[model samples]
Target: MKLLLLRNFVFTILQSGTVVGLIPFLIVEPKLNDMLTQQLKISHYLGMLIFTLGFFMMLICIRSFAIDGKGTLSPADPTKRLVIKGLYKFSRNPMYIGVLTILMGETIFFKSYQLLIYLLLIFIAFNIFIILVEEPRLRRDFGKEYLDYCKKVERWG
Candidate 1:
């Protein structure tokens, strides 16, 4: 129990720190709208539009998929039910994809190298969480059932 709590705490700290670290870079630091080209605002808007569409799809998929399977946002302790419907049918990690898309959108909008790097760090953390914390637990709990699901579903789509 203590180990689980510690792990959860550490995950929380990393996630919170990533956000806090990005806040200054996104809001306080002024970046040229576009360093490479003069059309920074146009690119920003384009990125925002693409991100918004992806985010919206993710939200819809989450509601349609996650709630049915009783999945939790955290990988620390997940529900017993295996979710392989809706977005899960398409992508094993829609929520993470959504989050990463948002981060990428922010990076494009802000044109901040620092925030982009932070976003990459967050992706690394999430990748580790999925590989180390989530998948093993699922394999342990679900066994052949999960293996079958894995056979059908791709990790990301």
Candidate 2:
């Protein structure tokens, strides 16, 4: 059990960290001077708060995946059971929402048009992937239970 959780955590970090961490850092280029000045701005604080909240949201979703679903966020190591607990109770794709929220926070914090564009692009891509790929797979995998859950929960939160 510990080994599986560790594996899930590692995969979540690698996959989500690359998307929400490494890519944003490349776009942000957070220098000390600019960072110092930005600290005083309201947008900076707001962004930090949103980012922190989004990070926590992702962590909770990851925990749900590991504990309830017995898997990680990676498709290669997907949940054996459908995750309909935690944030999942409210939204079918809370994890994806968490990723988008993080991107939004980054765009706001950095005040970068490029980051905004990236966020928008990722949003569209996530929608497409969920509709065409993930949803169908979930339906096929979990059948009636997943469909019933879908009926009970909104796709996004």
Candidate 3:
């Protein structure tokens, strides 16, 4: 119970902090690419839309894996059950992919290199969290089931 609490606390703080940090950076820098260029571009909006779609896909994956039980927090428990449908079929870490997509979308929308830097930091932090905390918990909880899943799905896909 205590370990679950600690895991939730740490992940929440890290996720919230990265998102909060991104907001101000996005706001201050408006559509820079538009201002710099005389003509508008279709590709920019298309890219943003694609990222938004990916973000929602990640949300769906998270929802599908959610445990109604109190003991589980991180969706790292393979014993909790396997989620192979929807976005889970495509990527093991849809939530992280969604997070990355949001960051990428922000970078595209705001046209800010600063937000890109923040996105890189977010990636690094998430990578550490997955490696140190999430993976070990999954291995402990799910054992062979998770190992098999790992073999099938790429970590960051």
Best by lDDT: 2
lDDT of 2 by residue, 5-83 (tens): 8988788779888889888788777553586574357897788888888888998998898899998888888899999
Instruction: Encode model 3's per-residue lDDT on 90-133: one tens digit a residue.
Output: 77777677777767876776566777787798789889988998
On the 0 to 100 scale, the lDDT of residue 128 in model 1 is 92
Residue pairs with colliding backbones in model 3 are none
TM-score for every candidate vs. truth?
Answer: 0.70, 0.93, 0.67
* Each model's lDDT: 0.66, 0.86, 0.63
Residue-level lDDT of model 1, residues 1-157, one tens digit each, is 4444454446434553346444634553554434535555786797688668656655654454345655444555455478777678787787678777777776777666776787788789888988998889889988998899888887777
lDDT of 1: 0.66
lDDT of 3 at 35: 54
Better of 1 and 3 by lDDT: 1
lDDT of 2: 0.86
Worst 10 residues of 1 by lDDT: 16-25
How far residue 46's Cα lies from its native spot in candidate 1, in Å, is 1.6
